[model samples]
Target chain A: MSKQTVFLVGATGETGESILRALLDDGSFEVTCFIRTASAHKPSVQRLKDKGLKVVFGELSDSTENLANLLVGIDTVILSIFAFDVGVEASLIQAASMARVKRFVPCGFGTPCPRGGVMALRDLKEVVHDQIFTLHLGYTIIDVGYWYEISSPRVPSGKFDYAIMVPRNKVIEGGTAPNMLIAKKDVGAITARIIKDDRTLNKRVYVCGDILTQNEINSIVEEKTGEKLELTNETTADVRKDLDQMNRAVQDDPSNLAHKYRLSNAQYNLSKYVRIDNTPEIAEYLGYIDGRKLFPDYVFQKFSDFVNDLAAGRVQRPYPHVSL
Target chain B: MSKQTVFLVGATGETGESILRALLDDGSFEVTCFIRTASAHKPSVQRLKDKGLKVVFGELSDSTENLANLLVGIDTVILSIFAFDVGVEASLIQAASMARVKRFVPCGFGTPCPRGGVMALRDLKEVVHDQIFTLHLGYTIIDVGYWYEISSPRVPSGKFDYAIMVPRNKVIEGGTAPNMLIAKKDVGAITARIIKDDRTLNKRVYVCGDILTQNEINSIVEEKTGEKLELTNETTADVRKDLDQMNRAVQDDPSNLAHKYRLSNAQYNLSKYVRIDNTPEIAEYLGYIDGRKLFPDYVFQKFSDFVNDLAAGRVQRPYPHVSL
Candidate 1:
């Protein structure tokens, strides 16, 4: 069989690189990555170039014509890029469908939305996912919940106090959500395995770490480092109420447009996925990850794109940049 | 009070021109007519130019940077351009608000979609209008119900052979639902009048034509013509059901996206303000155009734009472009 060209968007991010690495190991595929920003001085991007992967840099809102060129012969695509909760996903997916790309892997590193309370992920998702299904594109979503990488950045020990930003304030305090800390490599392996597995077609699956509930995950932190991790549960609901209030306030103050947009996006992304209790699912994926030998890509392209967006200044104030 | 410099979009369309003429007569506004298709033909644009109006040509797409110049020193704007249900209206309104234009008028030239049960129109009203209000743009809607010029273009001739298109395809040979007919000129007048009237701010007002109940319209036709005017009243229910069915069919057919857009638009325009069993509000604005007056400069501006659009092929099959 001829080798397939799999276009991976957002290949320059820390997590996206892992996914790209796994896709590269597949003998039957050649991978191309789309990035919107590239700094030659940046170590990660230059390293990616050294690996000999094709990288095309362009904005996320690139029109249909530009997309048609990138999609011309690609057999499969893994979308890991997103905007700040706008109609970008649906628009990009529609463009890809028009370009006749064979299969699409949407940025679904969370529980499936339908399995949740039919709550909208973002306003765009309400409009977009419907557009995706209605457009009749063959799609598979990588349901690898939240990434530890984004939330758990390393800082000098005791130099900085621990503070975690939750979607809003949660029910149970201190990390009640299950977080099976699957090594990045394990996440990578699962992604690569799915591309080769026909059974995963048109499906949404979980990829996680250890079988750990929110409490267990916190315990694991204690056990590993012997330093108690400060815990916080931020319920998405409280955040939404705050955002709704902010939106009302914004109507009276045009100056608050950006802030309202940010809050709304936060609420949308946090609530978009299936409301998995996560303890069982995280354990299940953690077991699966432990059983695997080689690392698989965790489909971190979207996160990677998020990084490029920050580096290029398309988006001001990253989550890390925001104090509150 | 200083006169406001108003920029009018789609000033050449039926209602748009009316709005322009009304504003022109009020003597409190300086109008800049936005001409989309007259880029190369300055003399063609000169029809408005001769009347001492400024004209600028460009596509009305959301990202048209040229609009920045038009927005400069522009105190108010009237957007009348329509695309086959695209996402540009709110984006443009936001742009206007950002430019600090004091007042904006939306192209709400139909039975207020709220009263009308057309889904596409309803969707447009929700998404577009909500976006406008969010932008904090002071706006008004000229809620004209139906165009007399667009329907039954030639009045009942002596023979009364002219055909009328109704939502009901299977009505009894002679049933009558109310037919509210406003000439294109009246639509323009209502649009023009809305922007100038302080009472119109933050409000939507209905513009109706000579309101004759279905039987009255047919009888009037019979009175004017030597032969009996055929009377057909498709019950509002049957017409709505048919329109809903057509809307679903059009939405499903991707290849016919543009055509479906037009059909749904027509269905929306025709279904509303049929005086289902009550008062037709045409009486409110009937006095606005008591006589066929001179070639109002604004009306001429519209005619000129239509000629330009026709010549430039911009008038390609309009949505619901009736074959009649």
Candidate 2:
């Protein structure tokens, strides 16, 4: 059988890199990375090129026609860019539609929250989803909840050095609500499987390695590292208060970088920890196919295993820390 | 004060014509109509041009940069196009943002409905709304419920000629819930007032001439015409069943024109008659300023007056009949 041809954007980003590596390792798909011309000289991009991956340099600001021309002959187009780049993603979706690509995997790799919430980013992502759905594009929307790489507290092992991942070891309301977590690498593997599976076409797929509350995750880490981590508890009301303040600040001065950053952080915390709508049951209610159920035999790395890796210094933080 | 330079799309459309007439009649704003080159030779475009209206020929499919160039020097951009032209509207919004237009009025001149409903068109409009808000473009979303021109029952008068306006004299579910209604001409006049008023900036404005149930409207029409029009009542459940069937048909064949038309008709019925979420209280709850409250002294044409005009063969249907 002929190999499936894939075109990917944001391949240099953390999630995109994981998907790229997984697709490459599978050796069953012809992968092409669509990197920005500005990022063409990046070592990460160059490394992908050296690995025999096809590279296409273009700008997201390019005309839809131009983007469509570039997407010609591609069977599937996968977007993994930042959620804020809605306009870019919109243009890409239009371009993919024009190119008559068979399938489109949009950038929605996160928790499943209801629309019209305090999270402005989710609203933006909803716009992209509506565009793809309304255009009747063959698409697969994958939400892998929170990434396991960023779900852990800062340990004494020093391997996971991102302080912003869990600020001050503060967990929300004891984190009693079950939250879905997936390793970043597993997201790529699951995405690869999802795009190729006919059942996932035009549907939302929920991929998760484990479903554990923040307290459960912390307990697992403590057992693995043999050290108790001091934790601070914050209520959802507190998060809501912070979110309201941030919303007002952003509304007052939308162009202020500091205000925008603070608003995004509050929104992220609210979505990841404060909200209790990230469980498998919520995913089912939202009409998401269970990835674990779909691939029952495929073993997924648990939170404990990730904690072991962090304590053993075998894994490192995937993204840099941006101090709030 | 200098006249606000206004750029308008869909000037030849029913709602656009109303807005264009209102803006021109107000004599307080300088209006320029952006029309498609393909429609340049139409009588509507020529008639506008003859009235000393500035007409710019361009297509919505034009590049964002090209559209932005045309929007230069315009203080406000008004979109009165069809709701289905969401992609076109998004590009125009981008261009408006790029051109630094002070305010944008999106194409949402209809009953106020919540997002993510069975009405796909509402979802499409939401996308445009999100884009304008996310881009930090100053925007005013105006929703003027059902148009009075089509809201009335068909009388013996030959002036009101559209049969599709209220097909078979069918009304939904006893119609006890108050539904907002506004004259098409009033929509344009209200929109003109809304754009000029500083209060409506970055807000949603709900314009209504009357809030009456279907039975109330029918009684008003019966009194005006001195003739009882035969009416058939349909329940909300019946409309929902039709909507579901149409939805399935559209899902099976998205490109089928018949299925699309049926789906849209069912959705329109559901939003207009079946749904009770279009009242002033609902609008206020949804953060919309009441247009009637904003301009208390302004005389609005009530349903009784509209019925009288229809009986006297004064007002004509703005839109043509599309057999469904």
Question: In candidate 2, what are the lDDT values of residues B144-164, reduced to their tens digit?
Answer: 888887677665553355432
Name the runs in model 2 displaced over 4 angstroms: A1-121, A124-324, B156-164, B249-261
RMSD (Å) per prediction: 20.7, 18.4
lDDT of 1 by residue, A1-324 (tens): 788778887665544656787777656678887766644446766777888878776665777777777788887878655433335655567667888877777665543233212233423443554455444566655655455433332222432223333322122434444433344444555777776665555444565554334555444434444555554445566556666776676677856545655564444334421133333333232111222222243333333333233233343222443443
Q: How high is each candidate's interface RMSD, in Å?
A: 20.7, 11.9
Give the alpha carbon lDDT tens digit for every residue of B10-96 in model 1: 765545656778778778888888886745375546677778887776666646345666688887788776534434665567678
Whole-model lDDT, model 2: 0.79
| lDDT at residue A190 of model 2 (Cα atoms) | 83
- Candidate 1 at A202: error in angstroms? 46
Most accurate candidate by TM-score: 2
Worst 10 residues of 2 chain A by lDDT: A159-168
After TM-score superposition, the amount by which residue B125's alpha carbon in candidate 1 deviates from its true location, in angstroms, is 3.9
